[model samples]
Target: MGNHTEVTEFILVSFNGQPQMQIVFLLLFLLMYTITLVGNAGMILITSCDSQLNTPMYYFLKNLSFLDICYSSVITPKAMVSFATGDMAISYNGCATQMFFFSLFGTTEAFFLAVMAYDRFIAVCSPLLYHTIMSKKRCMCLVCISYFFGCVNCCTQTGFTFSLAFCGPTHVNHFFCDVPAVMKASCSDTFVNEMVLLVVCGLIIVTTAIIVLVSYIYIVTTILHIPSGKGRHKAFSTCTSHLMAVSLFFGTVFFMYAQPGAMSSPNQGKVVSIFYTVVIPMLNPIIYSLRNKEVKEALIRQLKRKGFETIMDNCSTASEFILVGFRDLPELQVTFFITFLVLYITTVMGNGGMIAVISADSQLHTPMYYFLKNLSFLDLCYSSAIAPKALVNFFEEKNIISYEGCVAQLMLFTIFVTTEGFLLAVMAYDRFMAICYPLLYPTKMSKKSCNRLVATSYACGCINGVIQTSVSFHLRFCNLSKINHFFCDVPAVMNAATTYTYLNEAVMFSLCNVIIAITTVVIFTSYTYILSTILKIQSAEGRRKAFSTCASHITAVTIFYGTVFFIYAQPAAMSSPAQSKIVSVFYTLVIPMLNPLIYSLRNKDVKAALKRTLGKKRLFSMNR
Candidate 1:
C-alpha cells in the first residue's frame, strides 16, 4: 500500500463563472435538487403507502427512486454551496467518499433499471407467470443482487483511483470527484487507473445496458406477436416509463464514461454529467408517475387524503405559504436573479455607506443629517426584510415561507416602511424651517426635538406593524397556499384569507390611510410654506439655494409615496397582483438603492462632508 499522495485536498471547480451568473447557477441547481428530493421521495412514499402497488415492478421502482435521490444528493448540495460561495475545496478522504457513494448509487441505478426491464419483460412476454416467477422472495434477491454488483464496481473503481501516487496539482477540473478527473490530477502513472476505469466502468455499464436492451427487445417482440391491437398497446405502454427513464440514465452515462475522451471538452463533460447526475433524477419520478396509470391513480388518492388533512387545519390557520414569484415569466428567471442580486447588493452598500458616512463625519452631525442617517437605517432594514429571501426565492419553483416567517417579514417590512414615510414628513418640516425661519431654524429643528420626532415615527410605525401583522395572521387562510406576490405583503396575505376579511381589510386600510393622511398633510403643509418663503427671496441665487436643500427630500418622498400608495391605498382585489409586485419591487428594492444616491448626490453638505473626511484620512497618512 505505497500511497504517496501529497495533495491533502482538491479544488472542485464547480460551476465557475461571474458572481451574478454563479447565483443564477446556484438557483438553477438548487431548484433541480429540491425537485429531485420531493419527486423521488413522493414516488417512494406512494409506492410504500399504497396497497395496489405490491408488484415486482413497483418494488424495483421505489428502489430506483431512492437511488435517484441518493445519486442527486451525493453531489448536488455540495455543488450548490460551491456555486453560492465559490469555495470548492474537498479534502482527500472526502473526495474518495464522495466518489465511492456517487459511484455506488449511480451503478445501483443502472442495475435497477435493467432489473426493472427484466420485470417488464416477464410481465409482457410471460404474462400468467409474472407473479409466481417474480415473487416477493425473488424480487428481494434481485434488488440485493443489484446492490451487490454496485458495491463491487464502485469499490474496485474507487480503490484504484485513490491508490495513485503524489498528485501534480490538487485541482480536479470538475464539479465532483469522478475517476477520470481525479486520475488526470495525479503526477504518477495513471495507466492502471485508466485501465480500471475503462474495464470496470465499461463492464458495469455495458452489462446493465445489454440486459435492458435485450429485455426491451424480447418484450417488444412479445407485444408485436399479440393478436389484438389493444393487447399490443397495453403491453407496450407498461414499458414506456421504464424505457424513458432507462434511456435518459444510460444515454447520459454512456456519453460521459463509455466512450473515453468522447467528452471532447471539459465543459461538454460537465453538461452531459449534469443531465445524468442532477437532471435525470428529477425527471425519473415525473416519467414514472405520468406515464403509469396505476401510479398516477395512487398519487391522486394519496394527495386527496393529504390535502383533506392539510386544508382542514390550514384553512382555519395556515401552516405555511407557497409564494408564486414571477412564475409567469419563467424564461427571464436568470435575468431577474442577476438584476435583483445587483439591486440588493447596491441597496445594502448604498444605504450602509450613507449610515457610515453620517456616523463618521462631525460636519454631518446636524438635525438634517441625523434624520438622513435614520432614513438610511430604515431603508436598509426594509430592503433586508424582503430582498434576501426574495432573491433566493427566485431560484425556487415553490417559494415556501413558514407562517411565522410571513408574520415576521410583514411586521418588519411594515415597521421600516411606515417609519420611513413618517420620517420623510419630519424631513420636510426640517426643510421648511431651514428656508422660512432661517434664524430660529436651529432651535426649531433642535437635537432634542429631532430625536422626539424620529422616536415618534418609530413608535407609530411599531404600533401599525404589530396591529397589522397580528390581524393578518389571525384571519383564517383557508386552503390557499400559493401567495400571488413575493414576501408577505398585507394585501397578498389578506387575500389568502378564507373567511370574512372585512375586519382585516378595514384595519389595514384604516392604519395605512391614517399614516398616509397625516404624513401627506405634514409634507404638503411644510412644502407649501417653504415654497412661499423661497418665492419671497429677493435674489435668484437665494431661490436656487433654498430649492437645492429641498430637492432630494422631495425626490425621496415622491418615489416612496407613489409606489406605496399604488400598492396599499387601493383594495387588494382592485390591484393587479403583477402591478402590485412591480410597485412593491420599486419601494422595497429600487428605492432603498436610490434614496442614498439621491441624498448624497443632490445635497452639497453631504458632498463637502465626504471630501473633508477623505482629506483628514490623507493628512493622517502623510503625518504617519
Candidate 2:
C-alpha cells in the first residue's frame, strides 16, 4: 500500500547450473517424494484397515503421518518442479502461502508430540485412572484443540507477512518461500515480524518440551524404586521411541530457530531443516514400525496374505512367506544368533538365581527383600519379553508376534513395570526405616510387615496391568500396527492406534507426577535421615559399613533416574535423536544389566550367599 508499484512475483535462485546436477536433483527428489508419499500414506491406510490400531494414540499418529505428508508436500513439490523445469520462479503470494502452512504444520506436530509424551507418562505412572483420564471424547477434544491452535498460529504469521508491501527486490534466495527469505525481500520494516515469529515459535517449543521434561522426571523417579532389573527396563522401553522422536525433532528445530540470522548459513540451515523435515519423518515410521515386534508381525501377516493372493493370481501355490532380504546373510545371522543366545542365557541365569536366593533365604525377609524379588521377577519378565523375540528375529528368517501376543506382552510388561516403580519407593522407605530407626527397626518393619508390603506390591501390580490392558484393548487398531522396537512399549503400540490420545496423556501426566513426588519425598527424607545418622557416628568403620550397604542401591537409582529425568524433563526444543538413542539404550539395555551386577558384586551379603550356593553345588558334584 505504501509503494506505487505492485510486487507480484519472486524469482528463486537455483544451485549452480549443471544439466547433470539438475537431472540428479530431479531423480533424487522424485524418488524421495515417492518414498515419503508411500511411507506416510501406507501408514495411514494400514492404520485405517487394521482393527487393532483403533486407539487414541494411533488416532494421533494417523494425523501425524498426514502432517508429515503435508510437510513434505509443501517443500518437495516445489523443489521437484524446480528440478524438472529449471523454472525457479515463485510468486510472492505463493511463497507466503507455502511458508505459512509449512510453519503451521511443523509447529503443530511438535505440540502434538508433546501431547503424546504426556500420554505415555499417564500410561506408565497412573495405571489406575488412565481410562477416566483419557476417555475418547477428551482425546478428540485435544486433537481438535491442537489443530485449531496450529491454524491460529500459522494464520498470524501469514497475515503479518502478507500485509507487508514488497517495493524493492523480488528474489527469494532458497528453493522455497521460507519466512526468513520472504522477510529479506521486504522493503518495509520487518524486524517486528521477525521478532514476533521468534517469540511465538520459541514459546510453543519451550512450553511443550518443559511438559515432556517434567513428565519424564517423575517417570525416572518411579523407575528407580523398582528393585528388579527387568521390570525397570520394560518400563523404560515403552517410552524409548517417543523419547527418541522428541529429542530428534526438538534438537534440530531449536538449532535452526534459536540462533540469529548472521550466525546461520544457508547450507547449514538447509541441513538443519533436512534433519527434522526429511530424515526425522522417514525415521519415525521406521523406528516405530520396523523395530517393533508387534508391528513387524502385523506387516508380515499382511505381506503373507498379499503373497498368497499374488500366487493365486499366477495359478501357483504359496507355501511360505519368508522375509527375503536377509536370507543370504547366513554367516552374519549365525554370529548374531549365537551372540544373543549367550546374552540371553546369562540374563536368565543371573536374574533367576537372584530371585531364587532372595526367596529361599529367610534372613533376607524384609520389605527391602520383597522389593529385590519384584525387581528380579520384573527383570525376568522384561528380558523374556524382549530377548526371545530378538533372538528369534536374529536366527529365524522371519520375525513376527501375533496381535494378541503383542497385546498380552504389552499388558504383562506394563503391569510388572508400573509395579516396579512403586516397589522402588517402598524399598527406599524400608531402607530409611532400617537406617534411621535402627533401634526400633525390628519392631517397625517386622516379618509380618514385610509380607503385607509384598502383597500390596503384587496387588498394585495386578491393578496396573488391568488398567493399561483395558485402555489398550479398547482402542481401535489401525493398519499401521508396526512397532519399532524389540518389545511392545506403550508409544510403539500407541503409534498403531487410531483414536485420539489427549485423555491418555492427561491421566499419564497426573499419575507420573504423583508417583514421582511421593517416591521422591520418601527417598529424600530417608536419605536426609541416613546422612544425619552417619555424620553423628563417632566410629568411622560403622559409618562406612552403613554407607556401603546403600552404595549400590543409590548408584543404581541415580543411573536409572538420571537418564530418565534428562530425557523426559528437557524441552522438546533441546533434545536430538542422537541424544535420545543414547538415553534409550541406557534405560532399556544398559541399566537392566547393570542392576543385577551391582547388587551381586557390591553387597557383601549377596556375594556371601552366591559363594555359599556355588560352594555347595561344587561339593555335591564332588561327592557324586
Instruction: Tell me, by TM-score, which candidate is best.
Output: 1
What TM-score goes with each of the models? Answer: 0.53, 0.49
User: Stretches of candidate 2 above 4 Å error?
Assistant: 1-5, 14-20, 262-264, 300-624
Q: Put down candidate 2 lDDT per residue, 1-624, tens digits, no spaces.
A: 556148778777645333323433443455445546756776787676666676666767778888889987898888878876788888766877898888888878888887787777787788687778878897888777777778877888888777777874576666677666676667788878888778877888888899889889988888888889998998888788788888998888777665556224765665466556666776676456544555544543455455522222222222211222123456666775675577667667777888888776666665666678777777677657665766677655455566677777777776665566556656766777777788877776776666656565565556446545654544445433444444565544543444444333343444444444445554676688789988888899999988887887788677766765554333341224345534554565556666778778777777777777778789999999
Q: Which residue pairs show backbone clashes in model 1?
A: 315-478
lDDT of each: 0.82, 0.66
Q: How much is 180 displaced in model 1, in angstroms? A: 0.7
- Runs in model 1 lying further than 4 Å from the true structure: 1-3, 17-20, 303-624
lDDT: which candidate is best? Answer: 1
Model 1 error, position 387 (Å): 29
Residues 209-316, model 1: lDDT tens digits = 889989988988888899999988888889888878888888888877777785347778887887888889988987887557797667545655554222234344
Give the clash total for candidate 2. 48
- Weakest 10 consecutive residues, lDDT, candidate 2? 316-325
